[model samples]
Target: MPQPSKLHTRFVRQLLPLLVLAFVLSAASTTWFTHRSQLAQAQVQRSQTLVTLGAALVKPLWDCDGTTIQAVVQAMTDQPNVRSVLVQDQCNATTWQAGTQAQGPDLHTLTIPLLYYASTGRSYSVGALTITFTGVSVRTSLTHNVGLQLVVFATMLAAVLTGAAWVFRRIIGRPLHRLREAMRAHQELTPIPAHWAEELAEITATYNTQVQELRRQARHDPLTGLGNRTLLEEHLQRAIRRAERTRALGHVLLLDLDRFKPVNDTYGHAAGDAVLKTVAQRLLSCVRDTDTVARLGGDEFVVLTPDAPVEGSIQALAQRLRNAIEQPIDWNGRALQVRASIGVAQLLRDGTTSAALLASADAAMYAHKQQDR
Candidate 1:
């Protein structure tokens, strides 16, 4: 059976890839928006700056002052990312031009016209200024900003996942581990403390109910309410391992109820069931609390003594069991008497394995029945 913590861990592992994908998509969206906004702002700022520079050249251009126009054009071209500047007269004549033409398609261009007014208040275009901006510096800065944002986003994502893992461990994983331990120890199923998620509580309740039912059916015999053959084998194996470690003796006793078929033949299965229940109670009273008594099948039972006494004391124990089985049982005001033939096998003497020891005891039981015959 898998522990609850392991299941929780597995669930988290399955969710991690989705979480990372979400983070990546969110980051991509953020980067795209930020880049576009930065580019838009840079274009606006560059346009405004060029308009101001163009306004400064209006007076110098209208006067047709060559030195002042050249000085103004040189200042505009010297500004960072200013690729080219052109000034054209009202007659569509190029008067002043500086810097090379823009190299690539990635450029921001702005055009501003200079208006000259006559004494009659009519305005006519005297010249126009055209400026082209290269986007190389802007793109470089954007690249740097994107790198920084990636680092920040990655760090935040790590911290968020780490916190989530810790919360899951404390709230879900630990509770599941406790539940698993309780189940393994065969303790009463207690309701786990409520979690923040109602669904988790419902799932836990359902799981606990199913596990309890399964354990009950697996380990117990329905008829006598005693340990079943599966439980017997488990207890037998544990007893053998403990005996080997401690160098102590253990015993397995396989018993067959003598003349049990006659009871079924005389009074039917109901009367035989009563006899079996009564015999099971009697067997319980014959041994210590540490020992285990199991029903293997019809008319057959086994007892496991984890710490058996010496040979004489062990024989006495077996004799007591036989006497208990021979005692008369009253079922529905009718008295029923039965006898048991028991076979004995000792740990390290008969065999080490549960299968070997059970076989030896089975063979001894047939031998005892033959002697009685």
Candidate 2:
């Protein structure tokens, strides 16, 4: 199956980072809430412990010394992880006589009502004991909502940032780089890059295959599969361009079959077409594939040669074209002979347009036709 597009791939690439960040944030939020709940538990635990300690000294409240009270306070504060502990007596005079810890604005306080009960009825006693929790151990896991929120926000932010970079580099960057290198290699007409995506490679393969067909069509005739006028023009254009740019030698020959009209009139249009096909084959056999042989329609044709010596070479090509066409050919096993009046033209630097060059060759061919007559 073909892979998804680059756009979809990039989206998937970006989406993975977000998913990881979301997972991390969810875990972090769970952790933070768990910690918050633990803090609440700690609050309840300390308050209950203070109530027990305060209940012990109900009758001896009036006789309690600051030193004795401070001892209880010290003991509660020294309990493992407890930061500070304070206790208050119910009596209006003896309240708050525990713990040496100083109070901060961030303290948490819990109050418990004290009652004395007889078998007959319950009686209200000294009021209440207030336990204040503001100490070094708590460390303000949450302060005014902002501190806890900031910490959580920072964690999620870091995870997102790091995830974005990692996902982009791994998923998007590497593949995109490979794609770019493949495009460069294709532009240079070099071998396809190994790292090229399979889908892109398939597309390139299809495109190059179609291009090869188009190139073949451009250089070969549609009906007879021989070189056509367009092929001749292309080579002629290239030769002219090279002669101008690189000072190269170039020549073009125009050949018109002689006595071709009598064959067409005596045989038929089909026979005429066969004769043309036969002539094209002979012309093809006369020169290298590098040399272009083109049919300018009817009995007219042109041959183009580049890098050939100017003086003798152009005349020789003209003579060869004439001889190739004059040779006898078998059409459906019927033998026939044809002749061509050949004209030769040499191209100079910045010389002539294809039309003008062919016109010159045509005029020369007409001159030869008259001489042959």
lDDT of 2 by residue, 90-175 (tens): 55455454454455656566666656555689665644556666532323433344455567667866776588767766555665
Candidate 1: residue 316 Cα off by (Å): 27
- List where candidate 1 sits over 4 angstroms from the true fold: 1-16, 90-94, 136-144, 189-191, 195-221, 224-260, 263-373
lDDT of each: 0.83, 0.68
Candidate 1, residues 137-164, lDDT tens digits: the string is 4456557567776787688778877888
After TM-score superposition, the amount by which residue 131's alpha carbon in candidate 1 deviates from its true location, in angstroms, is: 0.8
* Candidate with the greatest TM-score versus the true structure: 1
Cα-based lDDT at residue 305, candidate 2? 75
Clash pairs, model 2 backbone: none
